[model samples]
Target: MRHARPLPTYLVQRYHGWKATAYHENKAWYRRLAKEGQHPRAMVISCCDSRVHVTSIFGADQGEFFIHRNIANLVPPHKPDGDLHGTSAALEYAVNVLKVAHIVVMGHSNCGGVKGCYDMCSGHAPELEEQASYVGRWMDLLRPGYERTAEIADPAERTRAMERQAVLVSLENLMTFPFVREAVEGEVMTLHGLWNDIGEGDLECYDPAKGDFVRV
Candidate 1:
């Protein structure tokens, strides 16, 4: 508590500006939203990368999407081992409570977390290999992805493939949850995988028919 301080001056100023303009203009909408509660259509699991703006990319308004962000946008395989699980909690809430129709796992280009997984799996990142490194342990989920892309000779292309695998792996892992699986099996829910090219502003979606990501 002693380390806590007031928000930064720039952020305070920006908040005030927003409050005076956007908030002022949308006061009724905000109040209605507060009263009605959220009923988002989809749950989006995306990277912690600052550049990957999920709401902006989808043109989503406030309360339109239930977003859960984590390193590499990963969803670990279901393990009800009586431990803390933030992403799983969110998924449970989104599916059981909110009952979102779609769950989208979105991966993006130049993801540092995916690159770290690649390096760690390749034995190039000793720090991540340590037992105490949280990131390394979490990224172990992507080891299968690294193995899938290891044969590619081009480093850049291999990294790109690894990034896509993040989305694919997460999509696969999502089905491990009984509730999610039941929902999908019952045709009430659908799973999607997306990859974004940040610089080019391009998006690709997984096409089950072709078994590859197609431009969107």
Candidate 2:
């Protein structure tokens, strides 16, 4: 711990500014949140990409949303093998413990995780094909999406398709959990898929009936 470097001056200054402004402005709300444990109505699973600001996009206040972020915002199929499953653990807590009425898997444009999967699957990144590549292995969950999008002739369009695929895949995998299935079937919980176009500041929601993402 002693070897850890001191916080950067710029980050420290920014934190102080935020603490003085936003923290001061919402002092009473913050205290209330601290006294009463969070009871968020929704849980959002989103990408770790720096550009994707889930709270900012949704204008969410503190403790309004219980969020979990990982590369590509993926959710693996339910596997009760007692292994280390960070996403699954978050899902379990959100659905069972928090009892959030809604679960949203939100993906974004130009995601590095999705791009890396495309490169590896398209033979553009041979190094990623190695056994030791953690990213490559994690992205294997998106391979089915890649396969479905590979036939597209337009590179840009294919990438967009893959991005949406990430959302669809997560939605499908979410149902693999028995609790999730029960909640959804009993109308106790609802699942949603969303994609954000960072550049254009556009949002899209998946329409299961049309099997495509519709701009919102």
Candidate 3:
């Protein structure tokens, strides 16, 4: 039989402290926010990494951004499955329901998904074929980019190439939805790509001018 485990003592204490602070110190903001609906101006597509906090990075207050997080923040080709597509659902809601003006797809350093695709494309991660998971299938979108970029000599270059490729793929996939395409072409909606590094606190933007991500 499995034994019952206790919650992390530190986490429990933090949770209680946060609850007390919210109830005592931040009640007004919470009450107003709770009564009103979110009217965010942007939707940010980001990874599920614990270190990458979108709110902290963007310096946004509550209800500023509608965030959609997946394994690698991939916007898959729109498929009408009669079921919910998590990322696509957020896009539809943000664009149609909320009418957000900007949609930002933020990629980052040391991305496990990009690294996984690089490994698979270079014949280093054969197990991807055996594991028929969503991540395995979703990450296949980067195959062409990884294959093309691996011809370079440096591993660092290949990783960077893969990272940028994922962002570009997401941007392209966003257009696969007819609504997104229409909104984008009509100039009512805009798309952006951003890169981040935790160690150096370096933020970069994908510059259309230079055709690369440079320091912001």
The lDDT values for all models are 0.94, 0.94, 0.83
lDDT of 3: 0.83
Who wins the TM-score comparison? Answer: 1
Q: Write the per-residue lDDT of candidate 1 for residues 127-190, one digit (tens) a residue.
A: 9999899999899989999999878988778989999999999999999999999999999999
What are the per-residue Cα lDDT tens digits for candidate 2 across 1-216? 789999999999999999999999999999999999999999999999999999999999889899999999999999999443999999999999999999999999999999999989989998889988888888989999999886798877897799999999999999999999999999999999999999999999999899889998
**TM-score of every candidate relative to the true structure:** 0.98, 0.96, 0.89
**Residue pairs in collision within model 2:** none
The segments of candidate 1 whose C-alpha lies over 4 angstroms from its true place after superposition are: 82-84
Off by over 4 Å in 2: 82-84
Q: Once model 2 is optimally superposed onto the true structure by TM-score, how far is the C-alpha of residue 121 displaced, in angstroms?
A: 0.8
Candidate 1 achieves a global lDDT of 0.94
